[model samples]
Target: MPEYPTALGASSRDSITLLGKDLATDVMGEVGFGELAFWLATQRRPTPGETRVFEAVLAALADHGFTPTAIVTRLTYLSAPDSVQGALAAGLLGGGSRFLGVTEDCGRFLHEVLVEREPPAGDDGWDELALEVVTAERAAGRFIPGLGHHVHKDGDPRTPRLFQIAREEGLVGPHLSLFAAIGRVHPRVLGKTLPLNGAGVCGAALADLGLPLELLRGFALLARTAGLIGQLAEELRHPVGNDIFLSVDLNNRSVPPSAQGGPHG
Candidate 1:
């Protein structure tokens, strides 16, 4: 017989247990989902500040209009209207290095910076360390993750607001500070206006919140799931995926119908 490793579990027939606690009596209504998420991930309850930071990060990344994930979700639904779970899974499947996966990349980068830096001596020390990290990354031909965006050219509007909330909660730390310092030196180092992006801030903030680097990106996945659900709901009402397909077909009408594929059933 094979043994299964498990920490999170549930027992059927009467009541359920999660993290060794009674689910219905100890958790179901007593704590908010954000707090529950923390407990589930860490196997311990979060402090008030930790909960606030976790929830804020989740809320901040929850959605962005017409993102690829949302588009894929809608298209999947068009192909199979009856499977809501399938549509949501299709959207989530788009998460990777180019998209939501960048959360993990950014988090790991910041973690590396923190690991390499000496204990802070003064304000100048942090700036010097941040500059060094940026310079090395640039020299290696690494396009720094979480620093630039295709849209929001001037700057990511979410960055400042997230920092502000972190400040209020006293959750700001070396990772967040170093990320911002790097942004200050960005124009000088890169000779371009690569502003700090939301994912960068999220990575830094989650680092400061003491989340493991491996789990940092999971927070983003969870947030985007909620956003995809909302998008799927709206998609059902407005129904644009078929129209988009038609538009593409109409524009490419010059191609021989034979090359487009056989007739659909």
Candidate 2:
């Protein structure tokens, strides 16, 4: 016989233990889902400040108003009302580069840059470093993760609020400092100012909180899970999926198969 060692959760005939505490008594009503999530990821309890910041990240990502993820979720549900999990999974699967994956991309990008150098002494130093980074990225023709927002061209509302919250909590680490500096200095290199989008800011904040860089997107998905459920709830009440499908189905024009190749071909 072989045994697997574990510290997360265990059940014995009459009792359940999680993170070495009574699951029913210590974890049920006493622990919040946000704090628990952080704890589960780090295997250590988070401070009140950490919990606040982490929960804010979750809230920031929870919904974005008819994003493709929400649309796919609703459409999937309409196609198969019997599989709620399928609908949710469909939405989560859509979390890639242009959507929730920005959280992870921004965090990892910032971390990679920070690890290559020492921490800056102040905003001026950070700004200088940011400028050099932006210039190099521009020269390389690479997009800066978390640089812009399609909807909030002027600014991302969530970006500043999260920065304020992190500042108040004294949890603004190097990742966020660098991200803010980038916001200030990128315009000089790119020749245009772009809002630091919410997903990108969430990535910076999560990195500052010392969350795993790889799992950053997982957190985004976690937040969007709530949004997908809300989308489904609204879908049940308002029922727009069929209309959306019909709109495209009815409006699309059919052309010869040769057109698929290209106009010149």
Candidate 3:
């Protein structure tokens, strides 16, 4: 007989194990969802500071008004009308390198820098290392993940606040310090100051807390699931998916011959 071993869970007569811990007595309702997520992903309990930072990250990413994911979910819901799970999955499916999934890349980038390079001695040392890293990324034609934003040109409001909270909780570490240093040198290196995006900030913080890089995107996905649910609820109240569908459909309709490019070349 062949058997597979599992550390995450197994059902029993009277209890269940999750990540090698008692699910009913140790976890159920006793911890916040964010805390539980961290535990399940890493198989270790989070510290008070880690828990606070994780919760903050989840709250920060839970919504972003009419983002592509929300729009896609609404449109999918309009088409299917009854498949809420499908709509949610449709939205999540769009998460990739440029979108919500960038958090994982950002975390991995920071982890590589922190793990492979010697810790910079002070501000100057950190800045120098940041410059080296940024320059190499640019040379490789890579946009630094977790830096810059489409709308928040000057800075991402959420990032500084998150950093402040982390500092207050004494959760600051080399990963975070290096991110700050990167921001400082970014303008000189890239000809524009790239403020830390919210996801990037969370990535650095999570990396500092010793979380696996693979879990970074999962956190973003979980947080955005809440945001998507809110979007769906609003969509139910104020229906606009039909309008969107109609607008797109109308735009794509074939133009009459007279209306095609001023009627003549």
Q: Best by lDDT, which number?
A: 2
Off by over 4 Å in 1: 1-6, 253-265
lDDT tens readout by residue for model 2, 101-161: 9999999999999997999999999999999999999999999999999999999999999
Cα-based lDDT for every prediction: 0.85, 0.96, 0.86
- Per-residue lDDT of model 3, residues 1-265, tens digit only: 9988987889889989888778888778787788888887888888888899888988988888878898999999998979999999988887788678767878888888878778889899999999999999988998888998888988889899989999999998898899898999988878977778988888888888888787788888899999999989999999989998899888896756664567364
Tens-place lDDT digits, model 1, residues 197-230: 8877898888887788898878899999999988
Q: Which residue runs does candidate 2 get wrong by more than 4 Å?
A: 259-265
Candidate 3, 243: how far from true, in Å? 1.5
Q: What is the lDDT of residue 172 in candidate 2?
A: 94
Candidate 3, superposed: residue stretches over 4 Å from native: 253-265
TM-score, per-candidate, Cα-based: 0.90, 0.97, 0.90
Query: Model 3 residue 153 lDDT?
Result: 85
lDDT of 2: 0.96
Which has the higher TM-score value, candidate number 1 or candidate number 2? 2
